[model samples]
Target: MKTPSDSQNNWDSLREKIIGLGDHSLRKTYYPELQQKLDDLQQSEERFRATFNQAAVGIALAGLDGRWLQINRKLCDTVGYTEEELKNLTFQDITHPDDLKVSLEWFHRVLAGEIRNYSIEKRYIHKNGSTVWINLTVSLVSESSGNHKYLIAVIEDITERKRTEEALRDAYNELDKRVAERTAELVKTITALQEEVADRITAEQALQAEMRERMRTMEELRRKDQMLMQQSRQAAMGEMIGNIAHQWRQPLNTIGLYIQGLLVPGECGEFSKEHLEAGVNKAMQVIFHMSQTIDDFRNFFRPDKEMTLFRVDEVVAKTVSLVEGSYRCQQIKVEVKTKGEPLINGYPNEYSQVLLNILINARDAFLEKKIADARVELRVFTEKGKAVVTITDNAGGIPAGILDRIFDPYFTTKGPDKGTGVGLYMSKTIIEKNMNGRLTARNTGNGAEFRIEV
Candidate 1:
């Protein structure tokens, strides 16, 4: 029933009496040291009491059975409960149902000596029916003999901390969602770009393939042209042989008649040495003439190895003369006219062949048509600094439909036996391609006229 002031006064009086005893009689004995030790123990006990009641965080003692035996002021404030009210309830009664099981598990493990201590975040139901989040640290206070004892729990209010952590988690989840959406869009863009590139590559490859095909076709056409040109040369050679036969026919018959007369000269009273020598000389002269004819045809048939300067008129006249025998046999007359000595720089042999091809073509046309009084008029002249030659035939004009294609290789209107079709084509090739001149055909007054200009 004593008041606090009376109790403090009595304690001070007892301490002063003990010190007075130690100073008067126990100063030289161990009693003064014993009194000093007792004073220090009292101070320490006071400090422990103050610290336990006024600690920053909640501190409490609980039974191994999860009962709360002691709780501090901080714990009461955290759970909105009085110390006496909390003491009436076990920690399990206030603990959230979701966290109760784990809390009990930790407590039992510590009680069983499986672990030294444990800390956990848990929730408690406050007296006001609000959620109180807390960090709980628990340890067992055991006897020295290691027997199970009460549990000591230290708790800190962490409601604000948990709220901050939840907010951060939500914001992070939103950021992750945006990143996923952006990444998906980027993937779509890249895929579209890839498809476009693939399409362009395919188109380019097709274009290249088409180009290769066209090149191959051009090369094939070139090879065919070369073959046709070669065939035209062979055909020309055959024509030369026929012309030679025509030219030699008359002289060979004359030689036979002369030799036959030599054996019968005595019967005619002409077997004298003078008559024999004169006859021999006449046969010798015929043989010489035949030899010269052979030489002329041979030289005309020889291909020019290189270009030379020559007269257009001369080439035209020479080419006509070479075929004069065949023309005569065919009853085709050829007349040559020269207005000027037109000069040309070209392959003379090829030029002669061109003229011969045209002349022969004219004769064949006349024979095919059976035209009476057929004639070919050839004129050589110079116009506008260009050498020009015109061979006009009286064998009737070419048909308009086939005239344009006359110079195309392997194109002809005559029967296969009469024409190989490359004659005029090769003639054009010689004048235009070989000699860089022009060879053209058109309808003139009498018939088809072939014009060559260089």
Candidate 2:
């Protein structure tokens, strides 16, 4: 058997090996299993830490007092706070005002162990004064001794989903409102359509009646136009007769005076061959002028059967010469400036008559106004590839507000006896209706301008 000393020696050697013998220790000999277990626990802890930091959803370890112990990267991103910043804040501090009561209630339930965990969709106030919606799931963490230690919170960002839901709700409301409005519009449209169907036949009958009335009115207008045209021609004939008389008055008197002078030379013996020749030549010139005047008057009264191309300047000059004596007698300065020898396909004699009537109206205006420095301007030129003529006169511009009515039929400033008033009415109709042309009038500062575009 073993002695006490041997037993003691065995016990000491075992303790020495287990603890330390010569340079060996108990830790090196016997604590390898515990150390390996501790190393394994530390590695697990490190892995958990890395996983928490790299997690997609927010993860937080908070104290029972609601203070944050640790916050992961996702939690920091969720609250727009840095990890260091979140460590100094509490969950209750960041909770939205409206959600604080519910969030606290759920948290207290978890703390009391009444629930294993609590999940609530709650709002948090971000640092920038914006709200963040999150689905927060919280669980209580306990020590091995069953003492509550910390809370583990997982926050899932649901702000975008909440916004989408809100947008869908708003869209539904707008769609409902639009549907109501469209329904009302459809109802009104159907009512209007029913009324239109009910009155369709009556409307057609009324339309036919209106057409007949229009035809009757058109016939009456045509008759009135014909009557006015006849009256206008008669007035023009009367004026032409007056002009002829004015033209012949001085010449006739001159011829008679010359005949009497022939008697003077025979009686006084002062008349020589030269004087007789001069007298005869002068009389022939006067007679020729008178004959030409009659021819001109006849041609002006004549009508054109078809259109012909004619020089605008020739017609204007001829028209001016027709009334030259009258304008000269009235001392009205008449000017004709033709820059481009404009040509037109039109009735020459009728156009000449139109010019004559306008001149006569101007003369009448000057007579009525008694203007000392009366002027009549006629300008013909090519504008926009069309022949344009403007007739302007210094008669104080048609008396202001009445200028628009001047072209109306039977509208005249002259007294009824002095004007037939159909002259300008006919002038406009011939220029616009007979020929493809336009006539417009406007008041200038010192006169009226009549523009004719052909």
Clash totals for all models, in order?
Answer: 0, 2
Query: Tens digit of lDDT per residue, candidate 1, span 372-453?
Result: 9999999888899999899999888999899899998888888887678888888888888889999999997779999999
TM-score of each: 0.53, 0.53
Q: Write the per-residue lDDT of candidate 2 for residues 154-270, one digit (tens) a residue.
A: 999999999999999999999999999999999999999999987997898999999999999999999998898888888888888888887888789999988878788889878
- How far in Å is the alpha carbon of 306 misplaced in model 2? 1.6
Give candidate 2 misplaced runs (Cα > 4 Å): 1-213, 270-277
How does residue 224 of candidate 1 score in lDDT?
A: 72
Question: What are the lDDT scores of the predictions, listed in order?
Answer: 0.84, 0.85
Tell me the RMSD of model 1 versus the true structure: 8.8
- For candidate 1, the TM-score is 0.53
